[model samples]
Target: MDGSSPAAAAVIERVLAFLDSKTVAACKTVNRTWYTLATIQSARNIDCHILQLSLRIAHYKRKGLLKSARSLTVDVSFVDGYLSPAAYERRVRDAAAMLQSSLMPVSHLKLHASSAHAALTDGEIHHGTTAIGLLTRALPSLASLDLSDCPAPLLTASRGECVASLGRLCRLKWLSLGSNDMSSATALRRMVRANVRTLVKLDGRGDVTDPTMQLLMDAPQLRQLDASGSGISDDCLLALVRKRGASLRELILSDCVRLTRHSIAQLTPKLLPQLASLDLYNVPVTTDAYQSLFNAQTHWPYLRDLKLKAAIHHASSRQESRATDDILESIGRNCPRLVSLRLFGCYGSTDSGLSAVLGNLGYLRELVVMHHPVDPLIDEEHSSSEAGGSQSGSSNTPTAAAPAANGPSSSLSSDADVWAGIPSLPSNGLPQHSSSARRAVLPLPSTAPSSPRPADAASGASSRQRIFTSGALRNGVRSQRFNLLNLDMTYDSECAAHLAKLSHLHTLCGRMITRHAKSLIEAQFPKCRMMVWNID
Candidate 1:
């Protein structure tokens, strides 16, 4: 309906709110009133690099842009289309200029200084600090600040300056100081103390200690806390939750050494009924705890992402495997809304258990399995005599850029079916990106003559060669890897058949998958990207 009348305008506005940015952008072409409304919606979250911001500002017009904008991300990584220490400083200056003059409506500001591809230098760090100072002071309406992606060294070095600059802002609703160690106790306390009132979501992974937890417990509005890889004890976590449990929605405690099954299990539904995500990487979870926490009757109704990577040293294969099985089994029955699940190094999950998980979680987008590098492709732990037969590295070595095809000594199978689920190789024989349109029948895995077993690893160390990892197809929502991962996992035909049935599935990664099953999955899902490993 046209916006001629007030009622019609209200209805149109309400409808626009439900639609996504692309849909909202398309609505602009309908009429003048739609264009004006759509423009505001489109500019609501302005996420761009320092280079792209000026262009976006020009398109939206400075005055309209300032009023319409709500979130601004000055990611300096994309400047000059490459990551260079020299160029980063200039982009930082450009960002500072923008934050100073413009961005009144913007409340959420993300200052991504450098990238993984770029090595951090003193120049970039200095400029990054300057940019942070300018934005915190300039943006009076600033409610959220995401410094998680910024280089850790920069954040750690300029702790005092950052705390001082951030204190200038009245309060922040969300603060992320994770991904790197900037968790000095004194500085963090001051920072958290300043933003305690409005702060709701806090990511202090690696830095949040028992003392910090004490301060966080005081924050009245705090709901989400990611204290993963921190030194917070079970008693502290239990105590903090008791104080802040009413509104706590997301709690990530991955790699928290002191936390045991008892403390985690003690987290009743009454404490965090609205808990949406729980990560316990390397933390051993008991059957009773999983059943209690994930049980529909007792606990979480909205839990979505559950990362329960069994503790390697603390967990035994047979025992932890059963725990993994129990958790996955309970998932379909208990946590149906679960779209992303991570179960790494759990010895118990067979093809049937995995198939059930895939089938049950209909809209399951991300599934991470066998992440812990428990067993390498070529076992280095054993000696030549212990291994029974150790192959000579020289005779069967693959190159750095592109590894050799499945040879007799190659870790994977030589059967054609093994490549079924993944995309077909191009005419040049290089692995291409996953595409449904160009479906070429792939050739069989080529084999080479078997190399004689070497006496010892040291004798063959110089002869060793590099293998390939699928960097192009890597889709890491959970980690910087594919969905299915097994360096030496037990995969078979039945599992492959059931997994292939998931037409929505995109990325597949793992090892020791049977040739026949791998082929079945590859053939069924022609668009799926894969990084499969050996059979035996």
Candidate 2:
């Protein structure tokens, strides 16, 4: 062991690299060489919040770890009311000193003070501003600077020192000053202009407006941009898109309520060939623009992940055409290599559209369509109750007979249990539902007409006489297969059966199916994970 070869030492070093921070930290005590190597690998990305900034600074200065570290994250918001004023000030000074001292030029630095009390006084803001200024000024080689969620009043109190320091970082690539109090478009433009060639990602989600859009246009190398929750208008967004669309790979414009069809009209596959991931949550576009987005000729070879959750019409009175179905069909046609898809709150999509889309995309790994429209046939009970105030007059129904079979007291409890997420269980933890309650929830038809009805009549037939039945969910596993089966859509017994039949189904989510259907699906595909909602 004393005369170990260089190969063995290399092997040991590689092995230790795979281990976690604590293990590598522990291994440092084994030998000097191991200590040096472990420090270089793990200490480079220090979380000052976890280790405590005071301790990390002392360790860094003493052990010469700061020189090797490339990234550092300091969270000093934890120093709150527990510490005395004097002690808190001292901690702040020490943290500030560490940031100010350039023992090593850090490339990436994230200083988070958001968790600090919302009632941060003027004095506290000034102190924070001074600290941020010191840190930004110290790291000239800093490529990625995330000073997000800093108390705005504090940044404003610094007399533009923090903003001025940011403006000097010529090598900055990814900058996130989002959720801050400052709204000086001049100062923001200066920062963007300083690193126009290098800036790749900018998150101005807080106070970014039309003015900042001009500076964004200068950043030709920008790839991923997030302007969510901003007041940027269609003109600004369009300008940014036309300027940076070619280089942009990922774009998140969620909750930019002002964005209209004109803003997204230029985002065709031909224009943004490199764009892969797009999130347009709550960004309203017109019917024509929506259709143009997924045209037959539109093709994004690398486009894989897309999120259109709650991307509804901005104007309630507009009566926009339902494009959810067309969008899904287009995604299947255009983005053939698509992997992850999320359609949360897509009210336009129906059961047929969903089935058709799934049938087309065999390579889908993650599918999440929460709040999918319920099938009119399967969710008959809900529709019936809505149509007529509770069918109490129908004495033949199990719901009416429930009070007679069990006492009136038990009937109310049973009815309460019928509500999703609530179950009437005994001491044993198993639910106790009466036969009448079960029959009421899923009633079976007493009789059926022998003769087949006309096409017109059959198409318009009501679900009142529809019979409820259960069988093995895996009866058609080979026909309609999928990789990730998440039936979180509204309850459709037929759909649940179809999902259960997928042999490759790995994850089942949602509360659409009944207990009986759940049991069959779980039993057949025991390996598949079921993500149950707590309030289902």
Candidate 3:
């Protein structure tokens, strides 16, 4: 009964396989059998790095655990001065040779680069030797490959050599070339065309163009396609969203600057009927279009994940417009089944906006929003993600996860199953750096930068009891609060009470929030932990 079934051993193996590192440690005290199961599961999701590359590989080989690695993250990324340039290259060469020869049948492989601030330093240094050739050449059996943190694109030894070798790869199920320069468009397209039959999820990181989307219509099983920040045209986008591609579920088109709300409104229920997660990061959508696209009763009744950024098109969008607020309200009323609602540039939103989302969407396990507008200093071009979990927030999505995409410095990343990571967003090839912004989250082992904490909001803490209300959550889903918030506005005691009611808050970025409110919330829910920006 201690495990998944009424008996200790029954179904325990499956249950043990899902525990994170922390949970795995706790399982050691349960019993020897459980300890063994937890240990194996932990080993399955180990990190293969460069600090002692050969030693690590030898250890894995000796134990015969190399072949059992389900989700392997070979994060060899270090800073510029971490080691001498010669030493760095030598270690990388040695690691690559070993990994190539070892041939660990790891289904999922995540490759990292030298440092998060690779943008400011050398151009293609590969500080940690996160070379594409190293990864693809070594893990030939990779079914899922993620390179969101690499210094450059998948050009390992030579210009087009490693990418050309992608043709030899076993049909990939999941591939994320996060923000890496995919200028080798022809080669990248060829690889996709070849693997069209097996490629299920692709995180292009916005480096792709219209042709890639065109090539995917024939992809019978392509469920998730993230073209965030790509130059995909409206016509091509519409063409791909048809009955033929109805199997498509998650579609991300953030910062497709060419898109208009009118074209977006055309996406009725008839197009990609199985749509669940839609992320339009920086895409310009009109107020009316927002309502129509998210028409739960009329359109996507099964929609779960919805990400809409505030306007990036200043000329077309009206400043001080209440469009975003209205849109959030509509979402709460319509998409009640939503699991994750992430809004990045929603500077126009106020208390009412977040309140509506919190009130409805009772089943929401992850709510990521920029509760306050970004100051001029806050970087928006870079992409930052956590190195903690998998791709999706939930466990059913992917075995391993990354941090949330906080623009390459204010990082965090995942969900229940979607190989939890930061929206599976491709980086701009350069890892992000942190700023002196304040962010708070459930305690965890993290490295996000922090600023000065703010003073308590004591003067405004009136003793009179206040009813901070947010219409009842959709379900009596009490154990159901999972949100990641980064706010800069000052809150009174009443605001804190309202937030406290949101029981399932997962992570929060209180960059300029008062200390009292943060302390109150952390005391109630102490689970999720990421980025460490400071308060006012």
Question: lDDT for each of the candidates?
Answer: 0.59, 0.60, 0.58
Q: What is the lDDT of residue 261 in candidate 1?
A: 78
- How many clashes in each candidate? 8, 2, 59
lDDT tens digits, residue span 1-536, model 3: 45544466657767877667798789878866777667667778767566566787788788777876677776655536777877777777787788778776678877775554535333244443344556676777678877676645333434433565666675788877765765645655766787788889988856677888888877777899888877888888888886345787888887788887756777766676788888876677766676666554554677898877644433332332223556777777777678877766453454465667666666777665553222112112211231122224333432111131224312221121111225333123322234321222211111112212222221111101011112222222333566554332343344456667764666654323456766776677667442323333
Winning model by TM-score: 2
Models sorted by lDDT, best on top:
2, 1, 3
Q: Write the per-residue lDDT of candidate 1 for residues 51-123, one digit (tens) a residue.
A: 5665676666654666777788876433343657556655555655765676457878887765765466655
What are the runs in model 1 whose C-alpha is more than 4 Å off?
Answer: 1-64, 75-103, 114-131, 151-161, 183-185, 284-299, 314-324, 349-365, 369-503, 508-524, 534-536
Question: TM-score of each candidate?
Answer: 0.61, 0.70, 0.62
- Which prediction has more favorable lDDT, 2 or 3? 2
lDDT of 1 at 393: 51
* Whole-structure CA lDDT of model 2: 0.60
The CA lDDT at 42 in model 1 is 74
TM-score pick, better of 2 and 3: 2
TM-score of 2: 0.70
Best by lDDT, which number?
A: 2
